[model samples]
Target: MPKISNQNLFDALLDSWDRNNTILVNLLQAFSHGGLEIRAMEGGPSIAELFTHMHYCRLIFVLEDAPECARPINRQEWASEQDPSVLARLLNESAAAVREAVKSRVEAGQDMLVHYDHPILMLQHMIWHEGYHHGQIKLALKLAGRPFSDDEAGLITWDVWMNKT
Candidate 1:
């Protein structure tokens, strides 16, 4: 097996973060046009609820807390419609928070340690979770007969950032 250098691993993680951010921004933009209905599955959370949940989860990771298991699981029966602009703002804030956390870890010389319950893991899991929800959002868009694009998905290739040496 080929050995991976610390710098390479950190770079890969950073790239993943960037790609995840791009996907999230695209999803938020898609939701902004006001055609898709964000609803939870089988009494689950609505799209807005999921977005808020993602934001809060990012905050928890930034504060270096353990990752919470499972989402709220129940929809707010009479939740108000979330503003697309607010969602966008939250996305930007969360991205910035993750980036800052990464920077701090690097500066503190703690990025090389393999932590089982590390904040980096939380951030990575949030990105993966976001991607999963984004897929669900795309499916909903298709079922609603709404137009969507894969421009952001194209921005997710690992090679783009990996070759930045």
Candidate 2:
């Protein structure tokens, strides 16, 4: 891809969030309400917790570093919703808030607490952070005995998140 604008980069990160979130939703859809809290591993978070963590991280960053742009996110989304689609919608809303936070800082010539001096790096940080947790989520699903495939892996691939002609 040619050099993408910072706005486009944030948009791509949002795309990545949505794509991975769909796979996470698909995995969770296989389980019952109680099943979302299952953790076959001893120490890791449950599927629901991991999903909540994803949104919480986004919420915290906006609250601490970019309060001016925190209005769009609903921070009280730590609890599990019965519908994965509902959870995905809330997560998307949180991500939109974070994106606006980054946009606000960039427009105001302010620095992010994450990547000093460059506001766009906040988007980079979130893209990587969410992807990291998503990998953990994949493992959590596997440990919970959910099957995986290349189709699911494709969700997190950069090419899938990239804009096309």
Candidate 3:
């Protein structure tokens, strides 16, 4: 495979994070009003809680690893029923904070030890965690009889990765 320059590699990583954030916000926005109350299973976290938890997880890492990026992210009580749009905004903000924290660490050649992992691992963790939650969100919608069409789901999750609108 052809090798990419360091800057290109970093940009790719940052773009991936941005796409992740976009997918997440789009998924949440796709929900109808009150769809946030949907849950994947009985007694499981609602869609709102899932979104909130994702943002909370990001904050935990940023607060510990990059306090400067933590200011814009307000701390919310876990699993609270805040508005979905509000959660989306917070998620975007937190994602930007994560991007900054990771970028600074990589550029300065500094090691960030969060949960015994480096910045790259931390970003991987966040992406994996959010993707898992995205599945849960979709499942919740389906369980509530409001599932997205195949095209919609594909666009939100897969096409976003390809940088397609």
Best by TM-score: 3
What's model 1's TM-score? 0.65
Each candidate's root-mean-square deviation in Å?
6.5, 4.3, 2.4
lDDT over C-alpha atoms for residue 107 of model 2: 66
Model 1 lDDT per residue over 56-151, tens place:
666655554322221222233333347777777767777777676765666565542334355467567777887787777667666556636555
How do the residues 62-95 of candidate 2 rate in per-residue lDDT, one tens digit apiece? 8778877765544555565445666676676777
Ten contiguous residues with the weakest lDDT in model 2: 154-163
Tens digits of per-residue lDDT for model 3, 1-165: 556776588788888888889899988768646777777888788778888888888888878886766655446636666587787778888898889888888778777755635677678888899888888777777877887888988877789897543
Candidate 3, run of 10 with poorest lDDT: 68-77
| Candidate 2 clashing pairs, residues 3+ apart or interchain | none
* Per-candidate total of colliding backbone pairs: 0, 0, 0
Top candidate (lDDT): 3
Which stretches in model 2 have alpha-carbon errors above 4 Å?
1-35, 72-78, 113-115, 155-159, 162-165
For lDDT, candidate 1 versus 3, the one ahead is 3
TM-score each candidate: 0.65, 0.71, 0.87
